[model samples]
Target: MSTAAERTTSPQPMNPDEEAFLRALGRVMTLLPRAIDADMMRDRQMPLSEYTALMNLSEAPGRQMRMNELATACMLSLSGMTRVVTRLESRGLAERVKCDEDARGLNAVLTDAGLARLREAWPAHLASVRRHVMDHLEGADLAAFTAVLNRFPL
Candidate 1:
């Protein structure tokens, strides 16, 4: 077995190429969301997080999903999703309803207004996505990249 000191030691330095790759990944992770959110806000639409929550709800069966499930789908914490849903509710885009299968559980249901809002926002969102991300992938092996990304643990 390894000694305690050895186990607690810092990991070896990454090679130059590995370091460069990590740096680039970090930059993308930090910048991508801000860039997209900026574009959405510039167009007077909701921020990316809210937009994402709406999109996920729209895709759910019956246009409704349990709050916790919606949070997971949106890759947000329950509290974060609650805040987003609250904002959505204020805008008449979504509403919380008791889950039919489980009365104690609450579901976020997309309303007609919500669908309309999503439809209105779709064009701007599409344009932003293209400009910030898809356009850059032109002529690249997207399938390969997708395969690699799919390997990541959720």
Candidate 2:
């Protein structure tokens, strides 16, 4: 087995092919989010972040979860989630609840209205997801594609 030094010093220079691959990967990463954003714009007038927050709430236990936890789940800061939750609350999609179990904590609960919005949005969103991702692969390749995504770092 090669030592770490040998591996690090291996005369291999990541040349044009590796460079091009990295660039292509970066481009795909940049573009896919924009495409999803466009889909959200057309379907429900929801921004991607808001829609994502709603989806996180939808998947949570009892369609409700603590604000701090929801923020982390959606990769947003607490303040950011608070702002988004305010917007959602104004639209009747979500509401802030006094955590009865903890006087100092708060939770976000998706309302029936939120479920309606999710129901309205699901067909278009699922179609977009399939169009952009799932529909491109064959049987085995589909499994492999998901496996790769599952292993990706957060």
Off by over 4 Å in 1: 1-12
Candidate 2: stretches off by over 4 Å: 1-17, 138-140
Error of 1 at 104 (Å): 1.6
Which of the numbered candidates is closest to the native, going by highest TM-score?
A: 1
lDDT of 1 by residue, 16-111 (tens): 999999999899889988998999888946899888988998899899999999999988899999999999999899999998997999999999
**lDDT of every model, 2 decimals:** 0.91, 0.87
Clashes of each: 0, 0
**Candidate 2 C-alpha error for residue 5, in Å:** 7.4
Model 1 lDDT, full chain set: 0.91
Q: Give the Å shift of residue 52 in candidate 2.
A: 1.6
